[model samples]
Target: MANFKLTISDKKGKSQSKELKDKEANVLVGMHVGNEVDATIVGLAGKLKITGGSDKSGIPMRGDVYGSARKKVLLSKGIGLKNAEKGQRRRRLIRGSTISEEIYQINCAYDGELKIEEAPKEEEKKA
Candidate 1:
């Protein structure tokens, strides 16, 4: 399993980092890092909750993007409204995407990094 580094920023403007395997990372890459997300009974959209993680943890994330799993959602217990606002809009799934595609989508939603690494030149094969 390849580990892709993830940087998730919470609503309070704090950011966290984590390493996800290809499959799991793919599913979360394009979602907003700190929004609460829940699954629709009919499977239309996932709910969004607060983004949570301790200051010592990397990418303190909460709220599952595709399903209703128990999560903290919020980062701070003392944080109150007016300082930040969370969104509830569900992300529309893209057509013809691999597992990586899901991560791509989540990152896209949160404006996550999708940098294309440049490939190094290699010797051509002689057939």
Candidate 2:
């Protein structure tokens, strides 16, 4: 079963993290960066857009790249490289845009109002 840690961000810049397992996580598999996810599946009411993600090994996903495999691409500035010269290019390891079972962290942008209902606590349930 696939497990994923989702980092959802809103227009206000506030972000929240959610952990999904099994079926919930499976819904995200095969989705690529720039794809829209069903907010209902993740307990949200707005639209969730996949921006980027990283694997368990910390390799970042790049939208320009295809498939779910990792590759060493020469970059001047982008996800893989933070500090770059005006005209500098270097080979860096980057994962493809597609989400796979190996991906652990997913970054998303949310649009629309968020209304998450809290689940009842164990004590409340017992009472």
Candidate 3:
């Protein structure tokens, strides 16, 4: 299995890092329904969910922050560990996925994207 070390950035161009399993990383590139793999977060419960934004069409749109590259970022619940609300009252729509975890969410930014290549893996020196 391959892993992607994603560098998540915020609107100001500041960045943070995280890792995702191979398949889950692919979903971010292909943002469509029925197109998430294991470890993929979906629906309105993740951090990448639009806490504040709207589609130009004037319709209420909320979901993952899909970008031009296959960067599967954001989260369901749009919920971050910071300033979070709990209980059944929290969800506008509830769906099941590992997406709710904090590991998935980086703070929202006007501009953020996943790094194109995996960081170099370390090699052990021979004794």
Candidate 4:
């Protein structure tokens, strides 16, 4: 079971906080950095974009960098004797992790009416 405190603000600049538990909090599982979810604030709807958050394991979640060509180019330019593995390690360090209950803090940006929906379901195909 996971517990989380969500602080959201609507377009009107009014802010409110809510505590989510269990199934409600599970909606955030598997969401990577920058992913957006519909949330409700004070009976109003809004969007919650995951700007940054951490896991119960204390590992910080970061947006994927593999999609960035500039970062790849810069990573390839390291010039130290032990630099061979630095880029590899750095890549592993910046990627976000699968969500877990340990996530205590989640920061998000709220916007206009966001319709909360059930988290996407995973389906497996029989081979």
Name the top lDDT candidate.
2
Q: After superposition, how far is residue 52 of candidate 4 from its true place, in Å?
A: 0.9
Q: On residues 1-127, what C-alpha lDDT tens digit does candidate 4 reach at each position?
A: 8787765655566655577888888888666667778765335565687766554453444454432112222233222113555446333232233445666766666767444455455653332
Stretches of candidate 1 above 4 Å error?
26-127
User: Which whole-number lDDT from 0 to 100 does residue 44 have in model 2?
Assistant: 77
Clashes of each: 24, 0, 13, 3
Evaluated against the true structure, the overall lDDT of model 1 is 0.33
In order, candidate lDDTs are: 0.33, 0.91, 0.34, 0.55
TM-score of 3: 0.24
lDDT of 3 by residue, 45-87 (tens): 2234212212222222233433222232333345221344453
Candidate 3 residues lying further than 4 Å off, grouped into runs, are: 28-127
Q: For residues 34-66, write the lDDT of model 1, one tens digit per residue.
A: 544442211224343324322222222233333
lDDT of 2 by residue, 1-127 (tens): 9999999888887788899999989999999999998888778786899999999989999999999998999999979998898999999999999999999999999997544558799999999
Please provide TM-scores, in order, for all candidate models, with all chains considered together.
Answer: 0.24, 0.87, 0.24, 0.50
How many pairs in model 3 have backbone atoms within 3 A of each other, for residues 3 or more apart or on separate chains, i.e. clashes? 13
Best by TM-score: 2
Model 4 accuracy (lDDT, Cα): 0.55
Q: Which has the better TM-score: candidate 2, or candidate 4? A: 2
